[model samples]
Target: MSNTISVTLTVNGKRQTITAASDTPLLWVLREELKLTGTKFGCGVGQCGACTVHLNGEPTQSCLHALKDVNGKTVTTIEGLSPDSSHPLQKAWLVEQVPQCGYCQSGQIMRAAGLLKQNPRPTREQIVEYMSPNICRCGTYVRIASAIERAARETGAQS
Candidate 1:
Protein backbone atom coordinates (compact mmCIF):
# COMPACT_ATOMS: atom_id res chain seq x y z
CA MET A 1 0.00 0.00 0.00
CA SER A 2 1.18 3.50 -0.76
CA ASN A 3 1.08 6.33 1.71
CA THR A 4 -2.52 7.23 2.40
CA ILE A 5 -3.09 10.92 2.71
CA SER A 6 -6.00 12.70 4.32
CA VAL A 7 -7.75 14.86 1.79
CA THR A 8 -10.51 17.16 2.89
CA LEU A 9 -12.67 18.26 -0.02
CA THR A 10 -15.95 20.08 -0.31
CA VAL A 11 -18.46 18.09 -2.28
CA ASN A 12 -21.97 19.18 -3.17
CA GLY A 13 -21.47 22.17 -0.89
CA LYS A 14 -20.51 19.85 1.96
CA ARG A 15 -17.03 19.20 3.22
CA GLN A 16 -15.71 15.63 3.01
CA THR A 17 -12.81 14.12 4.95
CA ILE A 18 -11.41 10.91 3.52
CA THR A 19 -8.18 8.90 3.71
CA ALA A 20 -6.77 7.25 0.65
CA ALA A 21 -3.66 6.89 -1.41
CA SER A 22 -2.70 10.08 -3.20
CA ASP A 23 -3.28 8.46 -6.58
CA THR A 24 -6.79 7.12 -5.82
CA PRO A 25 -9.26 8.40 -8.33
CA LEU A 26 -11.92 10.85 -7.24
CA LEU A 27 -14.64 8.66 -8.79
CA TRP A 28 -14.11 5.85 -6.29
CA VAL A 29 -13.94 8.31 -3.44
CA LEU A 30 -17.25 9.81 -4.41
CA ARG A 31 -19.08 6.56 -4.98
CA GLU A 32 -17.48 4.03 -2.65
CA GLU A 33 -16.33 6.34 0.11
CA LEU A 34 -18.81 9.20 0.14
CA LYS A 35 -21.81 7.18 -1.14
CA LEU A 36 -22.56 9.73 -3.80
CA THR A 37 -23.20 6.94 -6.23
CA GLY A 38 -25.15 8.96 -8.69
CA THR A 39 -21.90 9.54 -10.53
CA LYS A 40 -21.78 6.35 -12.57
CA PHE A 41 -18.74 4.35 -13.54
CA GLY A 42 -18.68 3.61 -17.25
CA CYS A 43 -15.30 3.87 -18.83
CA GLY A 44 -12.59 3.49 -16.22
CA VAL A 45 -10.58 5.75 -18.47
CA GLY A 46 -11.47 9.39 -19.07
CA GLN A 47 -12.91 9.14 -22.55
CA CYS A 48 -16.49 8.11 -21.69
CA GLY A 49 -17.42 10.95 -19.36
CA ALA A 50 -19.81 8.64 -17.46
CA CYS A 51 -18.07 9.37 -14.20
CA THR A 52 -17.94 13.12 -14.58
CA VAL A 53 -17.99 15.38 -11.56
CA HIS A 54 -17.27 18.98 -10.88
CA LEU A 55 -13.95 20.18 -9.52
CA ASN A 56 -13.97 23.81 -8.48
CA GLY A 57 -17.36 24.12 -10.20
CA GLU A 58 -16.05 22.89 -13.54
CA PRO A 59 -17.01 19.62 -15.15
CA THR A 60 -14.20 17.08 -14.73
CA GLN A 61 -13.66 13.40 -15.38
CA SER A 62 -13.49 11.86 -11.94
CA CYS A 63 -12.26 8.48 -13.12
CA LEU A 64 -8.87 9.90 -14.06
CA HIS A 65 -8.70 12.72 -11.50
CA ALA A 66 -6.67 11.93 -8.44
CA LEU A 67 -8.06 12.63 -4.98
CA LYS A 68 -4.92 14.57 -4.10
CA ASP A 69 -5.56 16.98 -6.94
CA VAL A 70 -9.00 17.78 -5.51
CA ASN A 71 -7.97 18.23 -1.91
CA GLY A 72 -9.53 21.32 -0.32
CA LYS A 73 -11.42 22.05 -3.51
CA THR A 74 -15.14 22.28 -4.13
CA VAL A 75 -16.60 19.33 -6.02
CA THR A 76 -20.14 18.92 -7.30
CA THR A 77 -21.80 15.82 -8.64
CA ILE A 78 -25.18 15.38 -10.26
CA GLU A 79 -26.78 15.05 -6.84
CA GLY A 80 -25.47 18.48 -5.90
CA LEU A 81 -27.06 20.18 -8.84
CA SER A 82 -30.26 20.54 -6.85
CA PRO A 83 -31.99 18.66 -4.11
CA ASP A 84 -35.55 18.83 -5.43
CA SER A 85 -34.82 19.10 -9.12
CA SER A 86 -35.53 22.82 -8.81
CA HIS A 87 -32.55 23.81 -10.88
CA PRO A 88 -33.59 25.05 -14.28
CA LEU A 89 -31.49 22.38 -15.94
CA GLN A 90 -33.05 19.62 -13.91
CA LYS A 91 -36.52 20.92 -14.56
CA ALA A 92 -35.72 21.25 -18.21
CA TRP A 93 -34.31 17.76 -18.25
CA LEU A 94 -37.52 16.37 -16.88
CA VAL A 95 -39.60 18.42 -19.21
CA GLU A 96 -37.42 17.51 -22.16
CA GLN A 97 -37.15 13.84 -21.12
CA VAL A 98 -33.43 13.77 -21.68
CA PRO A 99 -32.48 10.37 -20.36
CA GLN A 100 -32.79 7.17 -22.33
CA CYS A 101 -31.00 4.37 -20.48
CA GLY A 102 -30.08 6.82 -17.71
CA TYR A 103 -26.59 5.41 -17.40
CA CYS A 104 -24.89 8.65 -18.41
CA GLN A 105 -27.46 11.16 -17.21
CA SER A 106 -25.43 12.32 -14.26
CA GLY A 107 -22.44 13.23 -16.35
CA GLN A 108 -24.66 14.73 -18.98
CA ILE A 109 -26.35 16.86 -16.37
CA MET A 110 -23.05 18.04 -14.91
CA ARG A 111 -21.72 18.93 -18.32
CA ALA A 112 -24.94 20.82 -19.05
CA ALA A 113 -24.52 22.78 -15.84
CA GLY A 114 -21.01 23.81 -16.84
CA LEU A 115 -22.22 24.86 -20.25
CA LEU A 116 -25.02 26.90 -18.75
CA LYS A 117 -22.68 28.63 -16.31
CA GLN A 118 -20.73 29.99 -19.25
CA ASN A 119 -23.28 30.40 -22.03
CA PRO A 120 -26.87 30.83 -21.03
CA ARG A 121 -28.02 30.99 -24.61
CA PRO A 122 -25.91 28.57 -26.54
CA THR A 123 -26.95 27.80 -30.07
CA ARG A 124 -27.61 24.25 -31.22
CA GLU A 125 -24.23 23.99 -32.90
CA GLN A 126 -22.56 25.50 -29.86
CA ILE A 127 -24.15 22.93 -27.57
CA VAL A 128 -23.09 20.10 -29.84
CA GLU A 129 -19.57 21.43 -29.92
CA TYR A 130 -19.45 21.85 -26.16
CA MET A 131 -21.00 18.51 -25.19
CA SER A 132 -19.28 16.36 -27.74
CA PRO A 133 -16.95 14.89 -25.17
CA ASN A 134 -19.60 12.92 -23.32
CA ILE A 135 -20.89 9.82 -25.09
CA CYS A 136 -24.38 8.40 -24.47
CA ARG A 137 -25.09 4.89 -25.69
CA CYS A 138 -28.88 5.27 -25.42
CA GLY A 139 -28.89 7.95 -28.10
CA THR A 140 -30.45 10.69 -26.07
CA TYR A 141 -28.50 13.42 -27.78
CA VAL A 142 -31.53 15.11 -29.31
CA ARG A 143 -33.44 15.27 -26.07
CA ILE A 144 -30.31 16.26 -24.23
CA ALA A 145 -29.77 19.13 -26.62
CA SER A 146 -33.36 20.23 -26.23
CA ALA A 147 -33.10 20.04 -22.46
CA ILE A 148 -29.98 22.19 -22.49
CA GLU A 149 -31.66 24.72 -24.72
CA ARG A 150 -34.59 24.93 -22.37
CA ALA A 151 -32.35 25.30 -19.36
CA ALA A 152 -30.35 28.00 -21.10
CA ARG A 153 -33.46 29.96 -21.98
CA GLU A 154 -34.79 29.61 -18.46
CA THR A 155 -31.52 30.70 -16.93
CA GLY A 156 -31.23 33.62 -19.33
CA ALA A 157 -34.74 34.74 -18.48
CA GLN A 158 -33.97 34.63 -14.78
CA SER A 159 -30.71 36.48 -15.18
Candidate 2:
Protein backbone atom coordinates (compact mmCIF):
# COMPACT_ATOMS: atom_id res chain seq x y z
CA MET A 1 0.00 0.00 0.00
CA SER A 2 1.34 3.43 -0.92
CA ASN A 3 1.41 5.92 1.91
CA THR A 4 1.30 8.61 -0.71
CA ILE A 5 -1.92 10.54 -1.04
CA SER A 6 -3.25 13.01 -3.53
CA VAL A 7 -3.53 16.64 -2.63
CA THR A 8 -5.25 19.41 -4.51
CA LEU A 9 -4.37 23.01 -3.79
CA THR A 10 -4.31 26.33 -5.52
CA VAL A 11 -0.82 27.54 -6.38
CA ASN A 12 -0.11 30.89 -7.97
CA GLY A 13 -3.83 31.27 -8.70
CA LYS A 14 -4.07 27.89 -10.40
CA ARG A 15 -5.48 24.69 -9.03
CA GLN A 16 -3.05 21.80 -9.00
CA THR A 17 -3.39 18.16 -8.03
CA ILE A 18 -0.41 16.13 -6.99
CA THR A 19 0.32 12.81 -5.34
CA ALA A 20 3.08 12.43 -2.81
CA ALA A 21 3.78 11.13 0.65
CA SER A 22 1.60 12.76 3.26
CA ASP A 23 4.60 13.94 5.24
CA THR A 24 6.29 15.63 2.32
CA PRO A 25 7.13 19.23 3.00
CA LEU A 26 5.38 21.95 1.01
CA LEU A 27 8.76 23.29 -0.14
CA TRP A 28 9.42 20.06 -2.00
CA VAL A 29 5.91 19.99 -3.39
CA LEU A 30 6.25 23.47 -4.81
CA ARG A 31 9.73 22.88 -6.20
CA GLU A 32 9.58 19.27 -7.35
CA GLU A 33 5.97 18.54 -8.09
CA LEU A 34 4.67 21.92 -9.15
CA LYS A 35 7.94 23.23 -10.64
CA LEU A 36 7.63 26.46 -8.71
CA THR A 37 11.31 26.87 -7.87
CA GLY A 38 11.25 30.45 -6.72
CA THR A 39 10.49 29.28 -3.21
CA LYS A 40 13.95 28.23 -2.14
CA PHE A 41 15.06 25.64 0.38
CA GLY A 42 17.76 27.11 2.54
CA CYS A 43 17.32 24.96 5.59
CA GLY A 44 15.05 21.98 6.03
CA VAL A 45 14.43 22.92 9.66
CA GLY A 46 12.75 26.25 8.86
CA GLN A 47 15.23 28.39 10.76
CA CYS A 48 15.83 30.19 7.48
CA GLY A 49 13.07 31.93 5.57
CA ALA A 50 14.30 31.00 2.12
CA CYS A 51 11.23 28.84 1.65
CA THR A 52 8.66 31.43 2.56
CA VAL A 53 5.37 31.49 0.67
CA HIS A 54 1.92 32.89 1.20
CA LEU A 55 -0.49 30.36 2.58
CA ASN A 56 -4.04 31.61 2.62
CA GLY A 57 -2.53 35.07 2.19
CA GLU A 58 -0.27 34.71 5.20
CA PRO A 59 3.49 34.45 5.01
CA THR A 60 4.32 30.89 5.98
CA GLN A 61 7.55 28.91 6.02
CA SER A 62 7.03 26.37 3.30
CA CYS A 63 9.66 24.14 4.80
CA LEU A 64 7.59 23.77 7.93
CA HIS A 65 4.26 23.00 6.25
CA ALA A 66 3.52 19.47 5.16
CA LEU A 67 1.60 18.42 2.09
CA LYS A 68 -1.31 17.22 4.22
CA ASP A 69 -1.42 20.49 6.12
CA VAL A 70 -1.81 22.57 2.98
CA ASN A 71 -4.37 20.41 1.27
CA GLY A 72 -7.15 22.46 -0.30
CA LYS A 73 -5.50 25.65 0.85
CA THR A 74 -4.19 28.48 -1.29
CA VAL A 75 -0.46 29.04 -1.74
CA THR A 76 1.22 31.91 -3.51
CA THR A 77 4.82 31.60 -4.55
CA ILE A 78 7.08 34.38 -5.79
CA GLU A 79 5.87 33.82 -9.34
CA GLY A 80 2.38 34.72 -8.25
CA LEU A 81 3.44 37.99 -6.69
CA SER A 82 3.04 39.70 -10.05
CA PRO A 83 2.38 38.62 -13.57
CA ASP A 84 5.05 40.90 -14.99
CA SER A 85 7.28 41.59 -11.96
CA SER A 86 5.46 44.86 -11.51
CA HIS A 87 4.55 44.52 -7.86
CA PRO A 88 5.70 47.66 -6.12
CA LEU A 89 8.09 45.58 -4.08
CA GLN A 90 9.58 44.13 -7.23
CA LYS A 91 10.05 47.55 -8.74
CA ALA A 92 11.48 48.90 -5.54
CA TRP A 93 13.73 45.92 -5.18
CA LEU A 94 15.29 46.75 -8.49
CA VAL A 95 15.59 50.45 -7.71
CA GLU A 96 17.10 49.62 -4.34
CA GLN A 97 19.22 46.74 -5.68
CA VAL A 98 18.30 44.43 -2.82
CA PRO A 99 19.86 41.20 -4.05
CA GLN A 100 23.52 40.30 -3.92
CA CYS A 101 23.90 36.53 -4.18
CA GLY A 102 20.16 36.47 -4.93
CA TYR A 103 19.47 33.09 -3.40
CA CYS A 104 17.32 34.36 -0.56
CA GLN A 105 15.70 37.21 -2.49
CA SER A 106 12.50 35.47 -3.53
CA GLY A 107 11.79 34.45 0.02
CA GLN A 108 12.69 37.86 1.32
CA ILE A 109 10.38 39.47 -1.22
CA MET A 110 7.52 37.15 -0.31
CA ARG A 111 7.94 37.95 3.35
CA ALA A 112 8.07 41.64 2.61
CA ALA A 113 4.93 41.36 0.51
CA GLY A 114 3.11 39.81 3.45
CA LEU A 115 4.30 42.58 5.71
CA LEU A 116 3.07 45.23 3.32
CA LYS A 117 -0.30 43.55 2.99
CA GLN A 118 -0.69 43.72 6.75
CA ASN A 119 0.84 47.13 7.21
CA PRO A 120 1.33 49.12 4.08
CA ARG A 121 3.52 51.68 5.77
CA PRO A 122 5.68 49.92 8.24
CA THR A 123 8.31 51.89 10.06
CA ARG A 124 11.91 50.77 9.89
CA GLU A 125 11.52 49.09 13.27
CA GLN A 126 8.46 47.19 12.15
CA ILE A 127 10.15 46.22 8.90
CA VAL A 128 13.11 44.91 10.83
CA GLU A 129 10.95 42.95 13.22
CA TYR A 130 8.78 41.49 10.49
CA MET A 131 11.69 40.65 8.23
CA SER A 132 13.97 39.37 10.96
CA PRO A 133 13.22 35.75 10.19
CA ASN A 134 14.49 35.90 6.66
CA ILE A 135 18.25 35.91 6.37
CA CYS A 136 20.25 37.38 3.53
CA ARG A 137 23.79 36.05 3.87
CA CYS A 138 24.93 38.59 1.35
CA GLY A 139 24.48 41.22 4.07
CA THR A 140 22.06 43.22 1.99
CA TYR A 141 19.82 43.98 4.94
CA VAL A 142 20.05 47.71 4.42
CA ARG A 143 19.02 47.48 0.81
CA ILE A 144 16.21 45.11 1.66
CA ALA A 145 14.85 47.51 4.23
CA SER A 146 15.18 50.39 1.84
CA ALA A 147 13.28 48.55 -0.87
CA ILE A 148 10.49 47.70 1.52
CA GLU A 149 10.24 51.31 2.58
CA ARG A 150 10.20 52.45 -1.00
CA ALA A 151 7.53 49.94 -1.92
CA ALA A 152 5.48 50.92 1.07
CA ARG A 153 5.72 54.57 0.19
CA GLU A 154 4.79 53.95 -3.43
CA THR A 155 1.92 51.61 -2.60
CA GLY A 156 0.65 53.85 0.15
CA ALA A 157 0.30 56.71 -2.26
CA GLN A 158 -1.73 54.52 -4.63
CA SER A 159 -4.00 53.45 -1.80
RMSD of each: 1.1, 1.3
Native-structure RMSD, model 2: 1.3
Tens digit of per-residue lDDT, candidate 1, span 1-159: 568899999998888899999889999999999999999999889998899888998898999888778878998998888887698988998999888789999898899889888887899999999899899999999999999999888787887
Candidate 2 lDDT, tens digit per residue, 10-79? 9999999989999899999999998889999998898889999999999989999988888899999999
Q: Whole-model Cα lDDT per candidate?
A: 0.90, 0.94
- Top-scoring candidate (TM-score): 2
When summed lDDT is taken over every stretch of 10 residues in candidate 1, the lowest stretch is: 150-159
List TM-scores for all candidates, in order: 0.95, 0.97
Alpha carbon deviation, residue 79, candidate 2 (Å): 0.4
**Off by more than 4 A, model 1:** none
